[model samples]
Target: GDANRAEAALARAEGRIPDALFLIDQARIAFLEHDVSGTEDYWAACRIADEVGSTEIWLDIEVLATPEEHDTWDRLRTLPAADRDACAFFRRFWNRRAAAAGMGVDDRIVAHYQRTRFALDHYRRRGRVRPRFAARLGRPTNSVYDDRGLLYVRMGDPDEVAIHGGSDCIEPNISWAYDRPGGYRIYHLSPLAGVDDWYLQENLAIVYRCGSWDRNPMVAISPLLLDVPGQPFHDLYLSRMGLDPRYARIANHALSLIGDAFAGSRLAEELTVEREWTWQDGEYAISTVPERPAVDLSVDFALEWLQFRAPRPGLTRVWLNGLAEASALQPVEKEGQDVYRVQIVWTLLDETGLFYRFIPSSFDAAVDGPLDDEAGLSLRKSADLPPGTYRWMLAISDANSTADGQGKKVRGGYAGGDVVVRDLGTDLPVLSDVAVSADSVGAWSPTAGISLNPTPARLTGDDGVAFIYYEVYNLTPGGMYETRVVLQPEDGGPSFDLSYPGTAQRSASIVTRGHLRIDLSASSPGRYEMSVTVRDLTSGHVTLPVRTDILVTRD
Candidate 1:
């Protein structure tokens, strides 16, 4: 039967009527028929219709959604024509949902469709018949008019259900409750138009209605599980639910559970929480606050660094607040010398706050005497952080210490900072901030290549050469590009240009290096400006040049 309906829809699509509704019908029919590649075909048709400014087609797609979802879709579609691509919008929407669910988009969508079909079959087996009006109009029997069907399609099956009102003249209604791993939801439904078509009620208020209203009656669900951990989504859910005060406590409980679970994971090896009694001596505590100075969205990472003074060798604990995974303290050697360094890598989707604490080991207490001077510890860590402004607190503490002569204990130190992560547009070519390194060590990182050890911007003529490092993104793969670095003296002297021919790779980013040499015997010492430019030879597209100031000192 589905195949026959698909064939009819296909025939209508082939009529060259150029109607958006007909094309969408064809796509939906293909989906119903279990055509594997039909979704892409539907996307192609929608793209063409969008290019032709088919507003009616976009509206038709919105009508297929529940009232709340329809409102969201309509608002997105109302964006400028250039910003509205049906396929891209839908893909992004599904991708975001998948990310929130910690699942893949394709798998999630398939599950949704399968659940929809299962709901239809379930109602059919229960002897629920479609209304005459819906049947005559050729509407799907399990359309949104079927409240259970709609909920099942969006969120799978409910964990529990209850039927109410079987006495007197009162019509019977059903209540569905879901206790999903990600969240909870409750839906109240009643039959409409004296038919088997059930629709969600507007609210708890009892009212007799013949048709559906614009307001969606279903109680909005909030994520309640530890596994689904995105603060942005949680905040959004809270806002949508009118910010109930009780949710704050519930969220805190959930986070604690998540932390407990993470502490048992393999990643938590050698990690132990300090007991309250063991933390009695606070005088010898050390603290460091994490700072996010720069964020690059093009690479989906943020630059986080912190500096601290450790009075004694101790165990360090570092983790992102409200996250399930934490880093285990490992041995770090700098310049063949053992030191305390903490590195944390995070993604844009991760929670913002970072917690770090230090506890002195017994060995340190035996070997190293009371710390008289601060042993400075500085570290640089980078991770992906989505574009947003966040206020975060970095707390550091000394876990090993004794009370002073007066039995007075000191408290741990904390610092707060505002971090703003920016997004670089993908449509245009851009360059990262340039850093000059005298000698780089360690392995290459996504944010900073070659473990750059930055030196002062001043270059003496006797230094021979200075190495510059920068990254370019969104370059056309396989295209020939020219990179030019020029140095101009501040006193209106002639400029020196260093040019290099490069081949753009298939990757979205390219790291570049430039070397500049100054001869004191032949040049005047003054402030100099260094500029870097990249131009694509294939398309003749050029990026806006970036410049840095350098001081050329007399050797």
Candidate 2:
């Protein structure tokens, strides 16, 4: 009702008020009414207003509302108090997150705001606690939410919700379930005696009685004995049975959207509660949060990237590609020709904000692949990045793929770790990271540099050879050097270690390039860590080892 009243007032003074305060209030009112697009409009207006006093007030409230463990909140504290204006930093923070997730800033803000509204609408507690069976609840419970509300804010919505009423055997409680890529995740909340609020519980079970206190309501019984069919209690028991370890293959999964800072603390507390209490499985099983990939693609594919020294000083060049099986792509036939078209978007970010973004590349009608290979398509490109460790993401969309004209779903993913663009201008002996490929290192020459048809997937069937290419810089001229290569099985199986002895014959140059043919006939079918090490024997200097993962499959 208050939001409606505010909207009416704003509508009446629409063009009459151009002040920052008016714009800020309009933005707030729009957000309260779930007008995401309208809110963004007023938000832009407030940013350009000469006087930011009103904007500062709004930002200050948001900063206080955010959890201290949040990445942006923690960083805001480190800034000078004068620069801690939430409005000034909010755009930059969301911009980086959006860039890193391969999405538009407006889209990201809309999603976040919608989630916040959803939490408040569904999880926010309403009235004060009316003491159920005691004179007054012990602890003060004036918070806007209980445990469930706080979790809803941190995590999005649960896939399923179940509420069980108070019974002679068990207390009133609610449970949330998530069907994660790894396995199912469940959380239980129940009110304890003498406590004024709800808390996370470790186990969900129905109680029964036995022996001397069989008739007593306080007597607790073994939960295993209550397994029966066609009963409400039995149905709840069946839900608990789904938490078995065998059903969940493994617990290791990706971090939640909020990262591990706040999630970690909450998980630690849950674990402590588990250890202190008893469960049917001896210990409360706390698995990793559901794998929420920063970027999600509709089709299955692998992302491949390699960093190289740029022609311009202080800049590094990064090569990126997303490879998928040709069968996975739905290319349309146009003008009597097959058209395999895709739109590619690239974004790079550091701790601050958006650094650089490639002009989104799109193909109207392109060839599937080269004449030789038609099994897969390669969407390969390159970008020049300044020397720094940054997070990068690439999103690709099939130009023609759509459902009833509701725009094609973007198909791509982001790197799990930071993309470090090293300063390769130093005079010290240095070697580039090894690049693996299923094909040959096409044509190699001093002036032409080196060409490689790299296998972005880093996979090969058991034909028994992996072609590798790398460059060495600042080496001793006309000196002897030894290049060592090792393909160690990740599961501690046998390793393929070999050394290639060579000499640099050119006295005028210190840079050289080479390729290796490593035999994998003896290697088993599994993932292997391929390490390349180059040592200048004349100066007794060894470059650091560079490693990459390669998967081998038996034909």
Candidate 3:
């Protein structure tokens, strides 16, 4: 026997760091030879394995040192080589177990495993014989010699253990109690046939089976008691035992726990939260249903486009809630139906000759029948006002009346942001806001670009040309002016220049309009600065140059 064990030890020491495996081999041989130093040998092997960063070897030693069923040993040997690496395999196994228990592995799994291994070493050093399988001569028993050890591996250490009933005709048994969050679980176990093997017992018709153990033991139950179902070891164990419905419920709860845990992760926020109110503080294209009567008349109406996918086919009403200075506007009434509206009023914040229009606008679109899943709503409204900062709140509501007319109408969601309307001063030769138009669709108004569709200040070579529109106001009556357009790279590069001569007629109020198109198909992809300069040749004064940045992209 010594020669055989020495040969096994020699084999283990070959082609490997000798200390950990050699010590494990010594422990195994000593245990087989019934040497009293076996526990010390195993402990030394564990320490060395840990020191060498060979925790897998330490786990293997623990497994070999524990008693297990013969079939468990057979199954373990048949495991794929990938699964035989104890560290990696058990890490994944415990993570799965923790997830099934509705706990995150990041929180408590490593501590649990460490405590289990510590308990095993503590009990073994005390020479306390743990419950193991009934050892049969010449048959391999892979079962842990200690039933409590096996339970500890599966469920972690219990809160308390109580021994009862070794007196009179009552057979002695031990109860392991766990005070867990969901509830308390108490296991009743007793030795089988006065041996090291402990089996679960049913009392009062309640079967407390040792689900983690093999070789079920029988116990007499009181007939007067109603039969109670056995408790499973764990959720995953229940699933493995073919309890599909119970496992499904447990899995759903576990999924909910996972969702709650990582709900605030960056990836989750990116997927669910939208950055819709990040519009820059600038005048956006305001399209009105009816065009303004004159250039001097304040704009009384504005429309903002709102588009979103509906979760289901139904009437969706989108409206705006005005706050702060915008509260002056009354709710809009259309066909006797109260609708949300934003009123824009022009007010001069300073005596610097700048007038601002605070325009409040809102509307809703109603869909009545089944529509494309990717459905959208277009809304428009009018508001009269001077320029000022207005806080606008856009809300969407379910208009269930479009259906059979029964569901309760409720506000679904809302987005709020501030909009600034800068005043175009009339005292100087000022240019109106530059409008970049991509297509020629309507009668081009010098005050507004064709179609009034804001280009998002971007151009692509595929469009060939970009239409530019703006009006110069307060020019000297009967004045001759030289207008120049310069396009240069935003990085102060050489510029392309165009100059034209124009004359303003003598009138009470003078305004000069200009419309031009720039060929962009030849431009490279980058941000370009477009500057419009007007020189009043009669006064030899150049109006403040109006500059706008446009981004160009390759087709």
Candidate 4:
């Protein structure tokens, strides 16, 4: 509700003052509320105004936000955007906020979630959960915009734009008064062609002229999306050819994929009457064909050993696809059954990272009821889940959960529409280094993932620290893995390491590139280590072993 009120206030400000600060203020309000784009734009404005000072820029003022305020934006622009921008912003902000508050903000991300929740009671669609959750940004639904829902984001607040505001000398004498921070002003001098003109008070350009708000949204698939599979394909689609691609990695990737596939080269041919789809948009099947030509084949199987148990007493549901007979969950073995299945191993994972081969929660067993059931899918069986439309995926067999050695590998899979178990969690300790060229980020853009070739950068600064984190996956059961990384310069210059105890952890750990930050002041440095040991903990077992060498250094 606060965001809605703030938005409404901002919209009305466009009428009250034809300045940019009001819009910028509104954007700040959204940022304070964790509006992803709003936070990004505000910081961008704030940073740009400070570093590249110009009369036309209306963003964060160095006089108010200080040089430190612009520092975040400066550092953030180097990131690849998306959550990266958001993450960097908070890291910078919290550092400042902590200094201001005299205490550190919790580093655990999910912990800060509550403070960001939206007030659904206000400025929400008639019957929706949370605003963004129920409403797609660009898609037409019961949203506020139709078709393109055109929007323009500028630097600062619109109300603060200066212009003639007096009734003197027969001319319109209007000028913005409150040009300082903490206050936003706007002027609604006039509306033209049903579109009102508003500009920021400071640097102007903080004008926002939103089209007629749509109560019943016009539904179109969004051009913004994610890299994960089973997601609504956007940005990369044929329709979003002319859309803004900011923060649209998934869509951007798809667009790139399409380009690589030369989809445009065959656009005219694919749209012909004879070359249509078996499933139209939104599964609105418009075809007369009895069976779809593409039948995805798969299998399901259980691991040879497992002690499956749920955390609490709940319905043990069994589902799979492919073959004729169902799993052994319910005995009475039927004839002609294929035994290939993908079992979900949960014990093997946790948020910190993952070890290989954790036990599963369910195993194959014989049931007394029903025929050798056909492969199937499942959803929450009431009482256990909330009431909402949740999508799910089904597996006919274990093969559905996996691909053959020759076939492409899929990182994750869905048991039902909602329960997605990605085959990937943590990568076995691969080395990566974080190297910041300068203490003050001014002209320095930090680089990571260092190598031994070419020219290695010299790391500088007091308390200069390099973070080396490795990801691990598919570890041997009960078998421990250990690897020691050595840091050194190519020409026997200098190196560093984590001081003793803090440097080591069972199986995996993070260590300094070298013990002395001064050692890395050389022109070029190389981090060299020989032999990484990865052991599977299982006793007397021929466990599959995987080793990953992590290269961690401060560039």
Candidate No. with top lDDT: 2
* Residues 1-555, model 1: lDDT tens digits: 376866776686676766555666565566666664656655567667754434554443331343444455667667897786566555544443333333334444444455556666754323354433223322234353354565555444444555554222224566555432223344545563345656554321221222123232211211112232234323322321322233344334323434334334421221111111112111001010111111111111112321111112221112122111112112234455433322222222213222211111111111122222322222233333344454443333222322343213222233334554444344566554455433344232324334643333334434534555555556787778888878898988899887878877766544333332324335566777888888877777777777776665544
Q: TM-score for each prediction?
A: 0.34, 0.59, 0.31, 0.18
Clashes of 4: 102
Candidates' C-alpha lDDT: 0.42, 0.55, 0.41, 0.27
**Minimal lDDT window, size 10, model 2:** 247-256
Q: Candidate 1 overall Cα lDDT vs. reference? A: 0.42
Note the residue pairs that clash in candidate 2.
none
The TM-score, computed over Cα atoms with residue i paired to residue i, of candidate 1 is 0.34
The Cα RMSD in angstroms, rounded to one decimal, for candidate 1 relative to the true structure is 21.4
Residue-pair clashes per candidate, as listed?
Answer: 8, 0, 34, 102
Candidate 4 at residue 59, lDDT?
28
